[model samples]
Target: MKERFLRAGAAVLTAAALGAGLSACAPLVIGGGAMVGTLMAIDRRTAGTQVEDEGIELRAASRIRETLGDRAHINVTSYNRQVLLTGEVATAEDGQKAEQIVRGVENVLSVVNDLGIMPPSSLTQRSNDTFITGKVRASLVDAKDLTASAFKVVTERNVVYLMGRVTQREAKRSAEIARGVNGVRKVVRAFEVISEEELQRQLAQPAPVTQDPAAASAPARR
Candidate 1:
């Protein structure tokens, strides 16, 4: 029964994500740190880097919010410790301050400041940003040589920010794919570029699988 249930759940997710170019991990039903563990199994970054990136995001966000208060609207996305800041701010000084604040975060390696000098974005624009991000991510999934799970896609004001550790070929291909998405105004590569050889080495090593206890002891679903 457990095997059948898991198989059915996987099938439903596969169907739902088809044509959307999302990671198979996106719709996973696993819980807690287990969810992070499962996704990390297929992620390109080392587990340490993933943990650091998460830390950088949280630290940067907290600092940004505390320092800027309600005067500015900022979005921070950290991948492999490289942060990307987007959205709107009241002044150029505020934008610079936001980036500086993120830079002070311990694990942050670098930052890309794309915040505009304007009032905060409306709900409609933010919603559209979400839609565009999904579309770009889906497009990356459709790309033949690109691995959707290997990259992080963030969209703000129609600009698509791509982050990950990828080879030059993969990064360029990913940018091209993102640019082709309907609502993407531009594609910005914030990747930690690697060699093709390194990419292949990681690809050849299969992800470690942790058996679901209930399913493992059960009969096969087929």
Candidate 2:
């Protein structure tokens, strides 16, 4: 296990370095790679804490997928002990089963099952989602304006969910990129920002704003 972790760590570091190189125009892919690398590193550093959490999350997701038996397409994301399940299932029972599986995971503090009861994933939707995720990742990788590692992207039914700790500007840029991705229906932000003091400090920096020429002329005329 220790040897395996060492290998994983090396791979993650390599990915992170590669991701940094691609961060300018492929922020999404870089962000995704960074997220994965961070998770792997955490698991390596605190093998007991994170490995257990990951095991539980993956086990639960696999069980739910198996139980659904080809009727559903589920994506599971685990963060800090929280599990988010998204995608579609064929029936309400299948959704419930998914919830149960995630809840049964030992270290899961909470489970947000955003599983919709719908038909299996269409080829078109799958293809579009793949493309969107790839592009968004690429954008994150290439974005110079924000820390690409501070956001997480999840796509379902063409809508993109952005989550993590980021400044308002970072969040806005992330949303903009997601919106610009072809076939994206919507962009949702679920971010936690820094304290008010930090936000104020950032806001104090110079920024360009449009001035109203008519108002200036009116004041001069008066």
Candidate 3:
């Protein structure tokens, strides 16, 4: 069990490191070295689902802009089709409108609104939040027993929001990892938890023959 987790963790780091360094410049191929596109084979979501999430985010953002204009400063993050709405709006009504618009998007499983009903965050605050998010992500990558790619970290106002499809152990472990990172005031889990056995079944499944370049490039596009 330990060996399996370690192998998975190593794969996560390798893909992430190579992707950051070379994805802009080259592609990684496997199994007889055939050109198979970018190193986009590490995510838990399906290719179609990823594309759908992208569409959902874009449409929701557009709708918010059309409806509220500059009255709201919003961040839309979708994982496994679940939309997480953060940032601030000028009024409670605007916040509600933001969620309503996103919920209307196709393929959105649910909407988690953490939108503040106050003034928008300043650019300095947003920059600090981005830095905190990077710290948490790096801590997850340093964790030896968890698949960091299985988790998505988002931060707002010093709070860390975790999103993903994960097993119970992974959920608990990941939250702890995020908490240990400095400047993360609180950890909020928006994960879809699964059983350990289900995770093992997924790990044992064979890779699909066809690689969707669109799916492969999802992270890059983000």
Per-residue lDDT tens digits of candidate 3, residues 1-222?
534543454455445534532332122223212222122245577656666777787788788889998787788888888999988898888888888888888888899999988887776676677667767766776788877667777788889999998988899999998888888899999999989888888878764445555565667643
Per-residue lDDT of candidate 2, residues 66-120 (tens digit) = 7776777777766556677878888899888888888887778777778888876
Query: Would you list the rank order by lDDT, best first?
Result: 1, 3, 2
Score every model by TM-score.
0.78, 0.61, 0.78
> How far is each candidate from the true structure, as Cα RMSD in Å?
7.1, 18.0, 7.9
Worst 10 residues of 2 by lDDT: 24-33
Q: What are the lDDT figures for the candidates, one per model?
A: 0.74, 0.63, 0.74
Ranking by TM-score: 1, 3, 2
Question: Which portions of model 1 show Cα errors greater than 4 Å?
Answer: 1-34, 206-222
Task: Score residue 99 of candidate 3 by CA lDDT.
Answer: 85
Candidate 1 local distance difference test against the native: 0.74
lDDT of 1 by residue, 99-198 (tens): 8999889977788899999998776676677667767765665566666778887777888888899999888888888888898898888999999898
| TM-score of predicted structure 3 | 0.78
